[model samples]
Target chain A: MNILNGSAYPNNGVHLNKRHRKAKLFSMLCSLVTWLGVALLGVLLYQVSSDGFKWLDLQFLTSFPSRFPYKAGIKSALVGTLWLISMVAFIAIPIGVATALYLEELSGQGRMNRLIELNISNLAGVPSIVYGIIGLAVFVRGLALERSLVAGALTMSLLILPVIIIASREAIKSVPMSIRHAAFALGATRLQTARDHVLPASYSGILTGVILALSRAIGETAPLIMIGALTYVAFLPEGPMDSFTALPIQIYNWVSRPQQEFHQLAAGGIIVLLAVLLMMNTIAIVIRYKTERKYK
Target chain B: MTMGTFRLVKKDCINNRGTRWGESLIHCGLALCTLISIVTTFVIIAILAKESFGFFEEVSPVEFYFGTRWVPLLEPSSYGVLPLVWGTLSVTFGAALIAIPIGLASAIYLSEYASHRVRSIVKPLLELLAGIPTVVYGYFALTFITPLLKTVLPEIQVFNALSGAIVVGIMVLPMIATLSDNALRSVPDTLRQGAYALGATSYEVTTQVVVPAGLSGVMASFLLAISRAIGETMAVTLAVGATPNMSFTLLESIQTMTAYIVQISLGDTPAGGIAYQTLFAVAGFLFLITLLLNVLSQWFLNRYREVYD
Candidate 1:
């Protein structure tokens, strides 16, 4: 008021102050909403632990799922989740990294390159269930994979490939151009420059993306469900071709049942699922932070 | 020494040729790996198209698009997809209604008001929320949300759309918050400063200057969030139930396009059978809807992206 209208607006100052206070209150309300979100997460955790902690034991993790909730263990589902994640990482990482390298290093900002870039981003947003339908049609049926662990993994790999590729491309793009030039000055070819200079510099970032993608793959239920991951598996999958039930599917199955005990089991399964998810995410975030500091 | 040096030079030359050969081999392998992603898009489209063609041949387009009922398994199977589409619409609309305001409010707070220390603590928690599996959210919807709603609404069904929509809204909250935060943060500080110089309050500057500037990005985020809510399967499948009712009331149990796919796929529908083929047609519709939404969001993001020099 002093700067704009000098003493002329002095009488209006009270109104302006009132408006400012209202705005401040509104802003504070917004901040509270954000905290409300955090509080929701806390409540969810509290609920899960209260319902689930009693049943969460070594036997719960080791034994095969049983008809009785007390006897049921997540051994097969746990093992199946591990096997599925490994398979997804096996298929997604190298391909995602290579695609990132191709986009960041080899391709220019030509029309085709831009189209591919756009396609990758859009693919990232495609609903997980659509990927499930595709998996059902292609891998499970067309490829005759017979709803095996391999089929589930392939579907998940496809579902997460875009996330990994996008993250890797960002990592590769962040590597300084002078590093590649330094390698080239030593009589290195483009491939040699990328391999010796860029790839090493960006590998940590790439690893973070791969780990994050795998974390997501592990939590995914729809794509695996679409691929016909068995809802009830008494035995562990012997190989990639064998039928498997993952933790998420098991949780969903148990929740869908009418029994109160199964609901408790579902809560326990959520705890395990969330613990693994948070662990992987923490690892990814740590790697990302470390790499960021190193670069800085 | 000269004779030995000459031998070393000749050996180096041979090794260079071998390295070149190895490089080409590795290059081809990497390129093939990259090709898999491009091939995946085509394969999805082709498979959906082929099976969808079979479905359309059996069920007329008029009936498929305009028909109100969606009972594919029952006798005199009515393949009208309107019910499924409407189910999706109501669920998505409910989710958007829940997610957009809270998500945008939090985004504004994070971008404009949060201290750096508070931000670092909160951002990761949001990521953790995002990292939660949909299945777990499904379980929560069934076990927590539905029962909680029963206390408030007394006569709510066990598998109503309200709980499903609420959980789906929660699932999408992180996306909207993160994206809108990015959008708000990308607004130039100079604009806020200019407003402040004119004695505008922080709220005035944020809502008037920053939000308007970031409008397109925020709009894009809304579209992305809606698309996600629409495609969410397990939570809806579990909480919303598989009854394909065309009611607009959020309290009713409704089946979405995705829930239908899950319901059918969970059971053994034989290959080339009507039930199996019907899923592909639904998948094709879902694919088109999501692809269109994604492309539209991308377009908004690209076209109206505020570029600062």
Candidate 2:
């Protein structure tokens, strides 16, 4: 009886050891899979950056596109992108901020406010191409903006407006109620209190959110594609009504072509886009950090 | 007389007003913009409905809806939307299949398992994946992922749905991970502690207690991710072949609705033709699907209210 019990003990111990090993193996496998995803992203980034660096020069940055691959540059696309960003920012910021302020300060938690809030959140997640369709119908076709930079910009403004509103509301809500009450006690009206006391305090956060949204707008390609941004504009758009191409559109056009040189050019265009996005995001981060420090 | 007049003027200046017109004006302005945005959506739907009506006048609604063939440019062209819808679903499902597991795992690892240092390094790196433009992902899908897949599955077409789905899955990983992490972090610590006190494994606790608590948020994230995958344009356009086949084999190339839109937008279709009008009709369909998903996500978030406080 003693011998049999001792044998069962070893068997049970082996089974427990195997279970422990299985758990470890499973966890290790999961970790490895996660690393694989990260590694794939890293490798893709490296390839693009490396290939892109070969053609990334001041001339590549400043010159206009040419038929020759060596001489082709992204001047028109860059200017177009900048113009689009500016217009989108101009159109979206005021509306977004006002909507945010209204939601957070003015409106009571009633059905209308709740409905608007829900709509804004839903609109924020609507795929951008849907916005393109809306733009095509309303801006291009109905309003006869006719494939202009303004049409693209307006479309993009609508696209990111919800994001701006949501972020701005969060920023505004973060401001202490005490400050507003103090201003009110000092005989300031609600509007004056919000403008002078609340807005200034929330300015950094609002700016950060707006900048990030604009950064996203800058990288967008689908809506521009839908609204008929040119694929190969030789000259820069002098005004918002002029036909234009953006960096992503140019990159897409190049990459789609069955040529090795065009592929390199596409990579270069991507690098430029990444630089623009990185710059905007960095500024946003800096502002957020500064705001946090100031508040603290 | 001068002192009496001054006192009378001072007393007259005591009149006050409540809720200034300026505040009212600001609210009106916000209301106007919101009104415009809402009206714009309605106008789009109107235009889409009008054009789609015109399209159906040319073809039959029954054929467009249920017919399997989609030859829009051929002799006696059939405008069946099933092929495009099938392509959209298959690619989206493939992407969700890849993204859900990998993204959830990454979120779990970052929120529960990884150290703060690892999380800080990993999270931003993951976000960097998102910041990479979709067009770049298109290029990578075409140049890199396709070739990589071809090596192992030599029979795979160069511009197959699998490659597009994989690339899209990668593109949406950050969005899912970020949202799911937020959900996971919102789960209270007491539940985890209770599980630990019961001698449960960390994995068991995460799977059973924490994940269940965060299930709504997780579902919301998945829905959003799927919406994104469905609406994706560039990468799929570049990688997935423009063929409007309805086959489920990932090895074969297929055309999604967004790709078809991009295809027409690339200028083969003339303005005011059936094709151009069809773009709007298809866009309307795409819009409705995403809108439903977005509304569902919001409803789930509100309904769950998983926050302990």
The model with the greatest TM-score is 1
Model 1 misplacement above 4 A:
A1-14, A291-293, B1-19
What digit string (tens of lDDT, one per residue) describes model 1 on residues A1-296? 23345353355567797868978898999999999888878878888888898989999999888899999989999999999999998988888998888777754455556767787888898889889988888888889999898999899999999999999999898898888887888888877888878998998888988998899899889898888999889997899899999999989888899998998998998899999988888888788777663543
Candidate 2 Cα deviation (angstroms), residue A116: 0.7
Q: Estimate every model's Cα lDDT from 0 to 1.
A: 0.86, 0.82
User: In every candidate, what fraction of the native interface contacts is reproduced?
Assistant: 0.70, 0.39
Q: Which runs in model 2 stand beyond 4 Å of their true positions?
A: A1-30, A293-296, B1-19
Model 2 lDDT tens row, A92-176? 9988898787677755566566766777777787777878877877788779999899999999999999989999999998998
Q: Chain B alone: TM-score in each candidate?
A: 0.92, 0.90
Question: How well does candidate 2 reproduce the true complex, by DockQ?
Answer: 0.33
Docking quality of model 1: it rates as acceptable
Error of 2 at B191 (Å): 0.7
Error of 2 at B92 (Å): 0.7
lDDT of 1 at A259: 95
